[model samples]
Target: MELGLEVLGFLLTALVMIIEGIAVVMSRRPMHSILFLFLLLLTAAALFIELDAVVLALAELLIYNGGITILLTLAASIEPEEIRAPRIKPDIILPLVAAVILVFMISTYKFGNVSNFSYTSLGTFILSGYGILLLVVMVMSIAAALSATYMISKEDVGI
Candidate 1:
């Protein structure tokens, strides 16, 4: 049935979102965390799509994945290799996995049919909100990038 298939897709995307969120937070490496965070945002967009909020979904995809993650990655690139932390503790990894699985299981249950397209309804006038959001995300991304660069560049000289 169409409803069943839609629900299944939604559940799978939702599971991916939760798992990626856990991975992002649990990963010890900053670069890895940023990468997984990007994935989490993408999966979140997919979940939004299933719920029919195309506007919000696209916004998440563009702002988070398309802008912030890219900025984070750029900043991470400048991090000195020797200063980066080592691997994360397995003790934390195991519990994160368990939490992810539990979340997936609980979210599988059927909920109200959430299927409505938002982006398509906005028409050309969407330029207004779209433009504003784009400008804001760009400004924030730039600020984050500059701040990261400043942090990495700062250091106290040895006496």
Candidate 2:
């Protein structure tokens, strides 16, 4: 039963990741793409935790979803309408490529197993000043976006 649950979790995580990748490609809006990317990071973190990679999971959450996602969202907000409407190229082979890779990963790889490495040993490394600065930037940017979204929702300014 425990092993089955781990498998289920792995499958769920993979499904979310694939959707996120497809969303990144298929979405015309930059904001939606960033949102999906955030979701992808979240799911990946969850996967890491399930695999006993707690250190990596925390890093994924902190760096990708927390810091990078806010950066992406802010960039998208800079030119909302313009960024929303992107010129999509026609007739790409992304679907086929993604499908093949997905099959290969699922078939050849084993999921739901304990990670071979020790996560605790990796956590002793201190984050550098640049990493701290990036974290601060991510927090500020997300806070600004939250305030802006609230203000826009409550009080609309006619452009």
Candidate 3:
């Protein structure tokens, strides 16, 4: 029963990931594409969690979903209101239905039996070994965002 549940979870996550990925590519508007990308990253994180890679899942959520998606959304919003495409009414019902189904699936799955994964050791390894690399990446991302913002502001000011 547990194995069957795991397989089902994996399949559902995979299906969502694939659909969101295609949405990301096919979305006409920049904001819509970014939103789909966020969903894709979220499903990928969920897949990592199902595979018992808790640290990886967390990293995916923090770096891609939390950081990159926000950056892209900010960049997309830089477009002038007059030049941007007309807003389309989003399909709220579909997303709400999907969320409900996902919640139901999650509620039925047993999460207490998660394997003994040592988060502390993994943290220690990441900080001790690749700390500098992580720091560099974070700094670069921040710098990129700031530069993009500055450019947008400069354009607005006729600079």
Better of 1 and 2 by lDDT: 1
TM-score per candidate, chains pooled: 0.54, 0.53, 0.67
- Each prediction's whole-model lDDT (CA): 0.67, 0.65, 0.73
Error of 1 at 84 (Å): 6.8
lDDT of 2 by residue, 51-128 (tens): 677667778988897898897787768874753454443234335434543453355344555468754444344344
Off by over 4 Å in 3: 1-3, 80-105, 108-117, 127-159
Winning model by TM-score: 3
Model 2 clash number: 0
What ordering of candidates by lDDT runs from best to worst?
3, 1, 2
Q: Positional deviation of 76 in candidate 2, in angstroms? A: 1.5
Which TM-score value belongs to model 2?
Answer: 0.53
Write the residue-wise lDDT of candidate 3 on 64-127 in tens digits. 9899999889878987543445243337523853584467346644566565665658768888
Where does candidate 2 have its weakest 10-residue lDDT segment?
88-97
| Residue 14's lDDT in candidate 1 | 67
Error of 3 at 13 (Å): 0.9
Off by over 4 Å in 1: 1-3, 81-159
